[model samples]
Target chain A: MAYERKIGDTILSVDQISLAFGGVKALSNISFSVNQHEVFAIIGPNGAGKSSMLNCINGFYHPQEGTITFKGNTRRHVRPSEAAREGIARTFQNIALFKGMTTLDNIMTGRNTKMHKNIFWQALRFGPAEKEEMEHREVVERVIDFLEIEAIRKTPVGTLPYGLQKRVELGRALAAEPDLLLLDEPMAGMNLEEKQDMCRFILDVNDEFGTTIVLIEHDMGVVMDISDRVVVLDYGKKLADGTPDEVRSNQAVIDAYLGVAHDDAEE
Target chain B: MFYREAGQFKTSYRADQGILTIVQDRFVIGAFAFVAFCVVPFFINDYWANAILIHVLVYVLAALGLNILTGYCGQVSLGTGGFMAVGAYASYKLITAFPEMNFIVAILMSGGITAAVGVVFGLPSLRIKGFYLAVATLAAQFFLVWVFNKFGWFFNYSPTGMIVSPPREVFGFLVTGPQASPEARYLFCLSFVVVFALAAKNIVRGRVGRSWMAIRDMDIAAELIGIRPLEAKLTAFAVSSFYIGVAGALYFNVWLGSAEPTEAFDINQSFFVLFIIIIGGLGSILGSFLGAAFMVLVPITLKTVMVDGFGFAVGAAKHAEVMLLGTLIILFLIVEPHGLARLWQILKEKLRRWPFPY
Candidate 1:
């Protein structure tokens, strides 16, 4: 709390993005902009294209219509690896930790983009490769300490509980030292305590790293408390985008959540 | 009590990240190396070398290759034997074309050639996965064998379709052809296996290995984390093929002395290496060695027990060997799918705890 976190100019802007799977529209004309060092939340009902929107931003799902401008580079056909190179890293809704690998290794893998020692040197396992690995291992160990999962450092993530797995996934994304972090339901299926822990971690990451977060969460209370701005989507369309107070008072978002009154039913 | 690491501590990440981090492990490996490099050569004879040591080393090299592709990279390849054939034939052509070329260079270049072939076959992996990719590689297996079989050029227009290894030497020691000593042959193959196995271990523990595992575990997430699928899968294929190719080169030049492609490097050869990784423990470097040893030792042990001890006919014993291997593969799959390497790890874990119930 000693150092104030400031929200800066727009770092990512989605302009009229529309995505469809055959006849079904996953997201239609959805547009939003995220400012630097801000927690931007996307909350929507089930099947409201919440994941699809994240997918689009991360280049997993390419929009048929608009362009996504990230760090001033507009792209419609960005590959996920390219997006990652451009400083976008993410955790999946279902924890995507490398199950066979230890937690330490899973987090170390997040530093894949940073490490550049080639296959030949890696085979040698000496000089540059050894130095690179040790340096990255130090960074990964710090991430492990920060996430407070040092106890499970060598444990295979497949055997870990859901809450811990989610935390480890966050640890993996954090290990990348990403500029833009995409977290899909980082606290889903967790108890209140776990949710609180996750909220603290997310806020800490934002404050400590000054990372721009694009989070998709269904928890309204956590969303309103932590997010600088919230976007609501329904039926693959953006309903509202504003500060939590503004969106909370919007009648359209209310109707989208609570069904609208049918006046014709009185007839 | 001996294996306990109660007082030992690592002060640097470099020390901590070493492949043999445990003091006891380094000592054990050092002992094993001493036995392998120094002790084995002294006690070796034609029967031991040809029947067990040479065969096991060759299979270990091949299995390590396949394990890199199938185990570490999570890419199933049935083209291993075919790739090995490419190595054998390439080495044959290289040695014959440039008779003055060093045998080591010839073997390495053969490995390089197989790596290129592996990359070409690996291209389809970018589009397909799992069983479909397996089928694609299976096609490579059949097609490669067919090419070797049909082409007389591979055999250098040999009248009987047999490519024989012309006598080759390294430091005044005959390593290839019929005149090669069993000790020399074993040592030569052993040297390649030791160096390559170490290299394989290093590669699998590094960034390239991490990328391969990342793609294997969850490719979508891997891609999102900046690991390219094309690079990971293809590199797996190339590295795997390189090891297999080197194994093939040794198999021909040092062990067999002469090989017929269709007979030597066939579908059964492919399945043989596959079974090694399955029973040895998939995705483990030690498993590759353990699996290859298990595979090579099992049949030999079965034959010795059945034919030599029980006085069973050699032909019948061979049939029993095949049947027992099938049963063992199934047993390993059902009971401990992680294979012999996992069993070894479990034993080490128990050893560390000793009498403590906890």
Candidate 2:
């Protein structure tokens, strides 16, 4: 599968990105762009390189070929910390909240990059260090309130229900105030009500913060309902890229989902 | 009603994230500080001060160091005594070489020397974890002590491999040798412990501290969140060793006024410090102090009661004292796995809800 399109003022441009694990090619020459403030959904079957793409974007997996240019900056070797410092935040497919820490502390950990104070001031518990801590806490609290998780502020994240733990993971990413947010299956394993709440929060984050969201979602219904643009992939290659209606109507996509039309029916 | 944060609203983040937000906490800490610095010094004579205060201060430093590695960073270390030996021997060698160097600088420099040794031993930590890492550090415990003992140069080639204290003075007052007054030695150890303990508190609360806690809670998650584990782990080792080394230096210089390789840094010292943290609380500054005091006081209290208060023979009392300490460690572990710190938290919790059982 292959695709080509011009996005509106691209915020991230991936040109010929490829990756391999041992002798197997996980992603082969994949390319795409995510524009500012758009809900760009990457939909694909299992083993279609969706997670590999996300790993590349967040600097967890360094691509063997091509460039990842974010806001006009290109780098071959990027660390997760560098990506975070450059205003990219992400949640894992498997939730990775700090188990021993409170939900509030977990979110506050996301603000690690934004915090500026050193050890001296923290020891004294005075001056600039105290002021910086307070400022970060203010932002973290607002995120907690925004997600309506005030009741579990001091609860250790490990003990929370799966849905709430996922919410906490999202709140942590939000606490970073990233320019681009990559969410890998944000509604995975969630019931209908929890899914609905998460969808609303995702939209609100985009609308309120003007954040660009690149999400990998398995639920086609939710993807079709929320995505401004969709990119389809099959077996590590792009199958289709267009608006939801165009991708839904594409012959290849229809055949992939519904199988090829019978000659007898055509006769 | 008094202990609750219910009506004390925090409109600002500063107030919300403070170490002590409740008014009662502030008052309590203030009172504790007052007793430690002002009241205790007045009542104790020179002998008691030298015997108790100096020992307590030395343990406090060692405990603080162990807390950084095991408590804050979540790296279990069993080589604390080895690092202390490095400091003790290094200080001994440094003073012997440069007899005119200031005693404080020599002691602190010995801590720096121990930090270097700690980093070398700490390298194995990257490839292992938990009990494996603990065993890896045990290698440092045996190897370093053996090297110090084997090298006669550390003890100035003394026949018995023991380093006797050279004269040490502060502002022209003798403070380290046998002739030095116990008061001067007690005051010296006290001042050093106070300064470094405060410094340790600061390091743990800042970026370094948060990074350590992050690593402790979850290393993979911490790395994904942008904390480099190697840097954090190494820093914990270096700082932790620095504290342990200083404690070792003081142990020899101030308290014993003479040191042997077998005694200064040994397996028992490692277990002793580790027990203090376990019995006090892991990952807490106050817990380190409480734990150190508890460990030091328990055996002495037992000995005094058995031998002095009652009329038990000295040898029998000593045996019973050891048994009692072992029993207390087991009891503390079973009843409160979080150590004395958790007990402190429970007491505070109850005080907060005064006149209400719940």
Candidate 3:
């Protein structure tokens, strides 16, 4: 590993977060901090509220009680679009690619935040609008090349395979050039080879672009292999937070995953 | 062999991103424009100009407008007739009030006024979508026609309750009212269609179009990716209405010359435009033109074939034409739900891979 990236101060920190829907609690009092340029993984069982946490960070969900601090700004109710403008991007658990659009267009949409030309100028498609579009197309082409999906660039995303769709989803998120990338189960259903490719791409993105990654994955092998730090959640509460080795060694995390003494654990 | 792009490599993104990227496509468009502007007017008699071509061109604009909202942005609007009425009446008032104003300026201003009204009607789109939004726009259609019918100010308090285009001239050429030559009216409508259609094509391929499509495909993801649903939906409404408004102005002034609100901007007109997009193709600029032509030509073709060729009575032929058009529309929807544009695309793909489709 010749990558020599330095870990910097905290880029995103969640404090005293509690999310509930009427009677049921989704995430309660969960707290974690992610360092800049580091790969952070959140791992838990099916009902651990991992996706809800990502939604809150990206402003899709408003936590009943919490403050999310990103870069230096602190806010409680940031909008999804506003969060994207603040350099936060995410991919959904289920591939959310625009079914009617080509792979290239889907990726180009990630550059929406970067584009500023209004509808009037767009209608003319000359001068500023043309220049802006071409410039962004170049960036999007780079993402397509990096993901090695040039063959399917013109194909509608709905026509692509599951693994390819996931990769395209990643390409779309990358085209935004965000500082913080939240990936929900990027390798949930991948084969060994596909998983290896995704891991390499994720590591390379972290190294080349210095993007701070906060991902949720269920695979223990991937979490331990790539993540600099890991957090464990169970039933909407934080159980452990430390470097991979420490979290792995923690007895509570082991009991939570192995399901030992379930009756005693509830109390 | 002619349609393939095998050897036409685009060396730059600018060239690749052109509205007409293929040489053959560009040549085809150029040829069509030449035929339309140079050759057609010389041969266009009163019968063809007044009965068919101008009507097709005007509806093409309206179809393009509705397509922007329903096809591209996925906001189903049934208020097209109302929006067009706004344009027609607005232009009538502008033309009558400022008799010195150019018709082009009046038409453009009419489009602006309709865009504002469209945005107001489009506010409900943010909270509703799909068939629900369709219902909301349906309400707009009825409300607008009712207002125009109820209020005399819209029709300028005419004793006959009809709004008429005053005779207008551009550079000494009559363009409006009874004195305007059919050729002049044809050319006038032709110019607007050409420019606005090109502009529509440009808008749909750029960033604005992508945002609208994004919002259409999956709004939540679109919002998460930084597209404001408010801006995307409203802009779609505004742009769509602008085109419809221009079409409305042309429909009233150039095509009809005089129109009563109830008779002219009724619910059927809205459905007529909706059918154009449905049969032509949703979200396709070419589809708008194809759909409009299909809509306008079918009736004339039926009349010519039934009333003239087969010697059927005119009244019987008219009834048969309506039944046949309904059946054709249903058959088209069944055969290719994506519309004529998709069929055109499939044909091109096959042609490109000719000799062996594999």
Q: Judged by lDDT, which candidate is best?
A: 3
The candidate that achieves the highest TM-score relative to the unseen native structure: 3
Q: How many clashes in each candidate?
A: 0, 2, 0
**Candidate 3 lDDT tens digits, A12-94:** 99999999999989999999999999999999989899999999999999999989999999998999999999999999999
Q: Estimate every model's Cα lDDT from 0 to 1.
A: 0.92, 0.85, 0.93
Runs of candidate 3 exceeding 4 Å displacement? A262-267
Maximum-DockQ candidate: 3
Off by over 4 Å in 1: A1-3, A263-267
Better of 1 and 3 by lDDT: 3
Model 1 C-alpha lDDT per residue in residues B1-358, reported as the tens digit of each score: 5577788898988877778888899999999999989999999999999989999999999999999999988988888889999999999999999999999999999999999999999999999999999999999989998998899899999999999999999888999988888888888998999899999999988999989999889988899999999889999999999999999999888888899988899988999999999889999989988998998898888889999899999899999989997897788789898899999998888888888855
Interface RMSD of each: 0.7, 2.1, 0.6
For candidate 3, give the lDDT of residue B349.
Answer: 85
The full ranking of all candidates by DockQ, starting with the best, is 3, 1, 2
lDDT for B320 (candidate 3): 96
Residue B329, candidate 2: Cα error in Å is 2.3
DockQ of all candidate complexes: 0.87, 0.47, 0.89
RMSD (Cα, Å) of model 2: 4.5
